[model samples]
Structures are given as structure tokens and as C-alpha cells.
Target: MSDESAENLIAVGVHVIVKKHNFSKVYKVSENGTLMLGKNQKVEMHEVVGKPFWSTFEMIPKRGPSKNTYSLRLVERTESLNDLSGLKGQLSGQDNRLIVDYGTSQGLSKDEILRLQEAGKSGKEIIGSLIENSTSFAAKTEYSQEKYIRKKERKYMRFLTVCRPTIVSLHEMYFRQYHEKIGGLRMDALAQILCYSDVQADGLHLLYDSGCQGLPAAAMLNRIGENTSGHLINLHPGNVPQTAIVQAMNFPQELRDRHVAVNIYSFLRLHYQGESSMLDNISTSSKKVTDHIVERSVEKLNGETKSDEVSRTDTDISELETDAGENSTLFLRDAEKDADTLKRKLHEFEEAEEAVPVKKPKWFLETQRALDLLNSSKVRGLTVIAKEHPLNIVNALLPFLGASRPFVIFHTYREPLQETFMELKQKRNAINMRLFTNFLRSYQVLPDRTHPDILMSDTGGYILTGYLVQE
Candidate 1:
């Protein structure tokens, strides 16, 4: 393979899409591993290595010598979908009055279907055979026939398409299978959070997120851009912030460093008590070590110079005692000046000693960095997406945001945001507050059959957006 081809080829540890039945999922390609789709459904992932993104492969079932045992082999780097466009040319009845529902509509039995699968018939061929064997397929309406074909395709087809993972694609996968994991945050809702909060490059944003798996923080970081100096301080309830989705983003180390994940407890504790309160112990110990070193150096310098000064002072005293006149008074004044100069020089020497740099822990450094921004009220925006009461979290973190900066709160329930909205209004801490939800409906576009999808999410959760006002 050429160098260019190797660069484009899929490698381990990078996220890739595993698509089946028009639904897609994001999975990191691992070496010599298998991807589990469900309890009994999985695909051997080794074949996807070195395959280019967006390439498609067919899964062929090879029968074992033992009864009822088989393994799948992926072959044919061809692109295809479960398209019923060929059936588009076929006639359709106006209604399904003539159609009858029966379990025996498909003429192929389980054993025959297994045999056909073992014969290495491709997914498309198997779907076509199933469609041909269905006695009632022709009698169904166009929409019904299309639905039937899709249903059969899902069961028989094993086409895997590898796609380059994106933020939006991964968000959709989380929303579908693990909605609660992301705190029921929808893609549209997340987009609104970004827009309302005005997340952009070179902006300092603060976020308190839990149950979202770090998706909100990741989205903000992506918007902040990789090459900019924007920073995100993510506060989570857990001891360690959730970073699964963030890792999936595959952000560069420089961009990842811009994000500071800290525990909410520690952050709030430091914030309320001041930095000095927490660092006092560390500082006291550090100061003790530094003072001990400085004191020893000063004592050694004094011992070397003080003995000679004392001997000179004794000899001068003996000579001055014999004189007892203006010369002695003059000598006393000179001695006072010399003593002052020595004290000044000793202080200077102590100040000149190079102190060893104290290396702080990573968490302490990150927390302190975030604290500096918060204490200065430099955060341009604040977003709260938590499973807990948004009221308490928002009330505690809202003051850290700069004046006129935007703030958004997301919750799975409307009541929490409503309550928060009322409280913010009562306190007059925010203006232009709007509590609303989004209704998203997907569509299935086809010739003379374009309509809203029969199934849709009723609500994408609620969001309360407003701008903070200085008190």
C-alpha cells in the first residue's frame, strides 16, 4: 500500500461508525476484538482494520461442521443501502383491504433460511429472496411494502459501513440508546445551549454538568476550537468527571488541556473559603522548609563574620579606653554605621538565595487555575446540565459569570427549570429569561410518500436561558 493509502486507512483506537439497518453507532476500532451489538448479535471487528472510512462490507455466515454452529466472515468492500428504489417502479394498491395478516406469509422456513445464509448468499440477495417468497408482498400498499422490506432487511442483512465519527453522529447514538446517560440531553438542545451561551473560540466558559457524560463540555470545547486559548472549567458531582464522550471526540492534547475537570465539591469549597484557606497547610509546611534553609545560611554567614567583628571591637575598645576623647566618640558613631551596613548586606544575601520551585499536583494546579478565572469573574458563559435540582447549582455558580454574560440551564423535567426561572426573576439576578422546549420530528421523504415519521420524541427537554446582571 502507498503512504497516502495507509494514512487514509482506518486504524485502531479511532472512533468509527458501525451502521446497520439505516441506524448507525459509534465504536472505536480495537485490535483483535469483537463488537457486541446485542446479546446474540455481534461482528468480528478485525476485518475493518486498514479499511477506508465510509467503506461497506458484507457479513457472510460460514457453517461449522457441528450442527447449529456458524461464524461470520466480512467480505466485499462495496457500498450499498437497504434501498427499495427498485420497488418504486412496482405497482401499489390504493389500500391494504385485500392484504391478510398471517404468520405464514413468508414461504421460507427457518431451516431453509439458515441453509441459504450458510450458502454465502449476500444480505441483499437474502432480502430479495425473502421479499420474493412473501406471498402477501405484492398485495400490500406502497408504504406497507416499503415498511415490510425494511423490517425483513433488518433481520437478514448484515452490511457494516465504517464512517468517520463526528460530534453530531456520536451525540445521536448516545441520545438513542443511552438517553439517561447524557441526562436526556438532545442534539437540538445541546445546539441551543451552545448558541445561547455564545460559546466560541477565545472565550472562558464555566460548566457544571453531571449525568451528561461530559458531552456538553465536549461540545463547548469543540466550538472553542483547537488552536484558540478558550478554556472550559467543567465541574461534576462525581470524584472524577465523566470523560467517555470527550475521549471519543479525539481532540488534540493541546485542545484537551484547555478543559479543566474538577469535582464540584472541591471547587465550591475552595471558592467559598478562599485559596489561602486550603493552601495554608501546604504553604505552612513549604514555608517551614524554606525558612529552615534560609536561617541556616544566615547563621553560618554570621558565625564567620561575627567572631572577627568581636575581636576587632575588643582591640578598638582597649585603644579607645586609653584615649577617652573625641576619637572614641567618632569611633562609636562609625561602629554603629558599620553594624547597620552588615545587617543590610545579610538581609540582601538571604533574599538572593534561589528557592527551589515547588511542584504542585495536577488537580491542585487545575483547581487553582480555574479559581483564578472564577474569582476574577472572567467566565463569559455558564451552563448547568445536571440530574439534581438546577436551582441550587445555578444559584451557587451563577455569580461567577461576568456581567451581561449568557447562562443556560437544561433539565429533563420542566418543573425544575420553571422553578429556577421564577427564583432568578424574583432575585433579579438575570434578565431576558425564557424557559422553553423543542419539538423535533424526523421525516421519511419518498415519491408521493413523504411524511413525518410515525415515531418521534415529544420533547427534547427544557432549557432556561438568560443573561446575568451584576448586583
Candidate 2:
């Protein structure tokens, strides 16, 4: 491959677009891995690893491990049907009167097709053979013949295109199949949110994403670019933020670090009050949930072997590190051992050694850093895309946004944004507030047959956008 082609090679572990016909999906390319496309059909990832994006590959039937079974191997397609227009020359009737609905239109049987597959017949070759054997081939019109060939090709002519995953491709995939997972957020709506919020490189932005599989954050990060001063605080409602799309984007570690995913509860408390306030809440929650917790006490025997002592020591260190954030004090586990024993030892150790440093939890440290950023008042914009009511969330986060900056709120339903519009208007908290929805229609432009697609989504959800002002 040339240097240009090498630049577009599909790398392993990054998401790749697998497309066939009108349906498309995203899959992580892995070494020596295969993806199942249809019943008894599969495509190997190794075939596309060094291939450029949008390269088409044909699935060739191969012999499986068991006798008389066939599998598929993806091979780079070197041939193209550039003269498909010539197919019109061989037609007779103008409509489907000549075409029969019987299953025996083609001469080949299932066993013969399997035999052809086992005989190493390419998809194109097999499709050609089927066309040759079809009794209705020359009886139908050119359009009918083309439609018949296409329908057959989709089934017998197994081919797929390898595409590089992008925001548009990934979002389309999610919107088509997993609409509920992304809060029914359409691409146009997401684009509007980014544009309305003015998410660009080299500024601090805030996102309160209650859901959408991290798509809102990923879009903002993509716009923010790499090696820039831009930073984003992605505040999610859950303890573990859903960042599948973010990871799928395969961004560099530097760009990924610029995005801080913190829990909304911890961030707000830490920013407005202090770390102690969040810690107190955490401690209370942990206490309430510790009732069914079983505490395992590790005891070292006097006659323990050297290997056993080393293993137990490692276990102790791991547990201590894991539990350090929950209970700040280091405990002498050898002398004291019980569930409540940990609590008692923690109190005694804290009383005796007040100068000792305690390790903060990972979430706590992240919340601290985000809190610092919030306190600096550098956040230029705020975006809220949530499954819950956006009113309360917008009200809580609007105060942190910089004056005269933009904020965009997105909800699947318009009524919630309508209520938010009313609430913000009453409070006089924002100006230029616009609550609106988007309609996205796709078109299929072909030679002499251009028209809009047969089906389209009636609503792409609603967005409420505005500029914030200091009271």
C-alpha cells in the first residue's frame, strides 16, 4: 500500500464501520477476529486491518472444520460492474407479468449452491451462475431484472464495505437500532446543541449528560480537538458514566484526559460547599448499605510459610488500598479483626496519628479537580441532555455558566423543554431562549429516479437553547 493508503488503514481495537446494503453497524476491529453478518455468513477483521476505509470485500465460502460445512472468508474485491446500465439491453416485458412467484425460478438447488460454495466459487461468480439459470431472466423488464438481480445479490452475493467509524456513522448506527439507548437524540439535534453551545477548541465547557451513551460528550470532545487548551467537565448522574462511544472514538490519551467524567452529586457538593460535604454524604450512604456486607478477616499464622506470608501481605495491601477511601484511617488488622473491628481500629488510629495522610478515592480526586475548574469560573458554556426533567438540572447548572455564554438543553419530549422555557422565563434567568424541534428527511437521488426515502422519522426530538446572563 502507498503512504496515503497506509494512513487510512484500519487499526485494531478501534471501531470500524461494517456496512451491507442500507443497514450498517460498528464493530471493534481485532486481530484474527470475525463478525457474523447474516445466517451462516461472516467477515474476518484481519482482511480489513491493513485495508483503506470504504474498501469493499467479497465473502468467499470456505470449508468449515466439520465435514460438508462451509464458512466465509472476506477477500478484497478487485472487479467492478461499471456497465450495469448494459443490463437494460437484455429485457423484454415492461413489468412483472412475466416473472413468476414460484421458488424454483432459478435452476440451482440449496445443495448445489452449497457445493458451488465448497467448490470455491466467488460471490460474483455464484450470482452470475444464478442469473444464467433463472428462467425469468429474459422475460422481465430492465428495471425488474435489475431489482431481481439486486435482491438475489443481497442474499447470494455476500459483500461488505469497511468504513472508518466517525461521529456521523456511529450516531446513525445508534439512532437507527438503539434509539432508546441514546435518548432518541438525532444527529441534527446533537449538531444544533454543539453549535448553539459554541463548543470549540480552547475553552472550558460543562455537560450534564444524564444519558446518551456519552455521545454528547464525545461530540464536544471531537470539536475540541487535540493538543488544545479546551477542557470539558462531563457530569453524569450515575457513579459509573457510560462512555462506550467515547472509547469507541479511539481518541489519544491526552485528548481523553482533557475530559473529566465526574458524578453530578459529588461535583456540585464539592464545588459549592467543600470536599467534606461530599465525603459526609458518601459516608452516610456507605453506612446505610453496609448491613449485608460480609467482612473477611485475614489472619497470619505463626507457622505460615514464606510464600503464604507474601501472598497474604499482597492481599492485605490490595484490600487496604481498596478500602482506604471508605474509611480514611489505617487499621492494625492483626490485633483487631471483625466487620466493626475495622471501624474501631480506624477511630483509634485517627485519634493517635492525626498527622497521617489519608488517600482520597478516585472519584473524590476527580471531583476535586473539576471543582477547582468550576471555582475558577472558566466554564464558557453549559449543555444539558437528560432523560429526566431538564428544568431542575438547568436551574442548578445555569449559575455556573459564564455571563453572555450559550447553553443548550435537550430532551426527547418537547413538553419538558416547554416547561423549562416557562420556568426560565419566569425567573428572568436567560434571554433569547428558543425551544424547538428538528425534522430530518433523507433523500435517495438516483439517475431518473430521485425522491425522498420511503420512511422518515417524524420528530428528531426537541432542543431548548439560549444565552445566559448574570443576575
Candidate 3:
């Protein structure tokens, strides 16, 4: 890609879902093909490619009578965070309907309604027509009448606002949509992990994520400002790690370059295979050592044969090759000033070819590189989020962390983290250890009807966090 071409594009492989609300049918700007807007209108990749992030682009009809083709225009942008005080007193509720007021009105036929919906009428216009054609419209109470209009509006709504994707959106898309696969971790829970770990640019952090294609890992990447200079040594149980979530984040190649993956096998080999004495305090029994060595060799052998699988899961280079894949590795900045901030963060990274002793490679499981990273003494933090028990991992890895380095573990059930907390207590290797869960409450905001949502999430998962106090 030329420098001129790169300047005109937004995110290439990243597909932003265009929808009015979370429940609405989403139209995605993906590598699959042109998006079909309402009335069979199609939007090409080029139409969305040049648009700015967070800019709301609407589909307006051409002057001529072609309903299937639309011209894209940047109309406005809305901040995700906005004051709700101005949106109160808008809700209306009613008990019963009145059938006496609309006895003689003639409603439109079903065929007429279908025709109007297919005619590309605006959402307001269609709702108006529906209300006009419903003979019982006047019979409903004011609250019911409002609800009817709202339902019709949602049905006819076609316009969408394109916003920049972040951890909030990812939380909505993955955790809300596929909870079981995502390990039931909520946005606030992940936020707590980042906060407790003190994630920032230029820090070296440890992460273990196997759920939702590195969902936690992707979020950590987002929090660190797309690896301006920070480094994340991602440790996974298997040789071929699932990295779909991180790849979906659309971070720049420079940012993706900051991520390094290590298999538990290679890391154990370096940690306990007589390379260092970190594991010396642990049981020196021959049986345990023999079993560990056997496991490591088996895992390492299995990992070496997974090159093809690793490429499919970890590398985003080939992901956007679909018809709409722009195939550009550059990341788009929302503003010049944001780019300046990232540049300053990356000054140290730019000056040095390798910030950590372990060099980052394009592949996921570079055994030698993984070993080097595991042995590095500069680790500032560690985060564990997995479906399996985290205590075993914490015990094995905490010995290498520098004193005062913090770590966090996330679990849907408190039992796992609770057990890990107790183990830390016994060893006296952690300080300020605490186990807690977060509850999230949301509200329904509208013009004069804002109130708390009827439902709230009871669980944001359990967090057991503490800092390492190396013996």
C-alpha cells in the first residue's frame, strides 16, 4: 500500500456492525461483500473505507429513482458517553385500551403496508403511515400508543451510526452475545483487572487467556493504547493459541508486533529444566521432575507440528483477504494529536530493536523467544483469566515476578480464585490479596422517560488480585 492510499483508509480487516440498537439486525462492513442496506440498497467497501472513525454516515437516496443504490454522507457524530439529565420524563405507561374511539375508520390493507415498507420510506414516515392505517390507534391509551410507535420505529429503522470499536463494544459483542464461550467475564470485571494490574504504556505484563480468542488479551491491548511501547507476553496452555479476538481488534501492525505468545510447555522447560533455580524451592522429588519433563517434551513436540494451525488463528495477515479485504497493515488514527501521543510512547521502542531480552516474532509459539521472555526479570504485572484453575499457574509463575509486581485472576466462580488466594496467603508471596465481584446496573434513557433498566447483571465474575512479595 502506498503512503497516499494508506491515508485515505479506515480499518481494513475490522468489521464494524451498523445497527441502531444491540437487538437490531446488524449490517456489517466486512470482507464478505457489499452490505445490503434497507430496500435492497448496497454499500461497497470503498464507500465506508474513506470515512473517519466515529463519524456517522447515513444512506441517502440519489436524485434519480434508483432505490437499491445509495450515496454515503458524513452527517454527524455522537459521543458514547453523554449526559442523561436532559432526557427525563419521556416514559408513558397505560393499563387498558379504549375501543370506543375508532369504530368507523378504514385501515390500510396488508398488501398496502408491505408496499410502503419496500418503497424506501423513512422510519418516521412508515410509522406515521402505520398509525394512520390502524383503525384502533385512537383506542389505545397514551402509554400504549407510545409503545406502538416505538416498535414500528425499530422495525423500519435503517439508518446506522458508525462508531469506533473499543472494549465496550467488544464486551457487548462477545460477552453479551456468547457468554459461555467468553468465560462469563464482563466489561467491568476486565476493567478491574486492568486497573488492579496498573496497565500502562511501556510496561511488561503477563497474561494467560484462552477464552473467546484472547478477549482479555485484546482488551489489555486496547487499554495500553495499542502497544505504543508496552509489551504483553501472552501465555496460553496450548501451542496454537486462539487469537481471533485480538486480530479482530484491528490494531496496527506495530501494535500487534508487541504481543508475544508462549506455550506452557516451552516456558516450563526454561523455568524448571535446570536453566534457572526459580523452581528450586518447589518439590525436588524425582517423580515430580520426571513427570514435568515428560509433559514438557510431549507438549513441545505437539507444538512444533502446529505451524499451519497457529497461522490460521494468530496471524491477521490473511484474515482480510475476502472480497472487501483492503489488505493494509496500517492502523488509522482518529486524530493527529492521538498519533502524536502514541509516537512519544513509542520513542523507546523505536530506539531499541528489542526492548525485552525476548524478541517478538510473527509466529505464536517461538520456543526460544518464549523461553527468553519467561526468564526476563522486568515483569511488572500478570493477569490470569481462564476457564481452568489459575492457582497452579500463579504458583508456578509468581516466583519470577519482581517484588511489588501485581497480578490478578478472574473466575466466574469464587471457589477457584478463593483457593488461589489461600495458597498465596500460605506462601506469603502476595500482599493486599482480595477477592471480590462487581455488579453492573444500567438505565434506559430517553426524552423525559429515563429510568433504571428493568434488568441488571448480577455477576461480573470474581476477581482475586494481589501483588507479588518475592521471598
Q: What ranges in model 3 sit over 4 Å off?
A: 1-11, 23-32, 35-46, 55-106, 226-228, 274-365, 445-451
Q: lDDT (CA) for every model shown?
A: 0.78, 0.77, 0.65
Q: Which candidate should be chosen as best, given lDDT against the real structure?
A: 1
> Per-residue alpha-carbon lDDT of model 3 for 311-375, expressed as tens digits?
54555645545512231211222233444555565555444623433323334235556556656
RMSD of each: 16.8, 9.7, 18.4
Clashing pairs in 2: none
Q: Which stretches of candidate 2 lie over 4 Å from their true place?
A: 1-7, 66-89, 98-100, 280-357
Ranking by TM-score: 2, 1, 3
User: What lDDT, from 0 to 1, does candidate 3 have?
Assistant: 0.65
Q: Which digits, one per residue and each the tens of the lDDT, describe model 1 over residues 140-229?
A: 787888777777667776777777767798888888878778877888889999999989898689999887877998899889987897
Error of 1 at 390 (Å): 1.6
Position 121, candidate 3: lDDT: 64
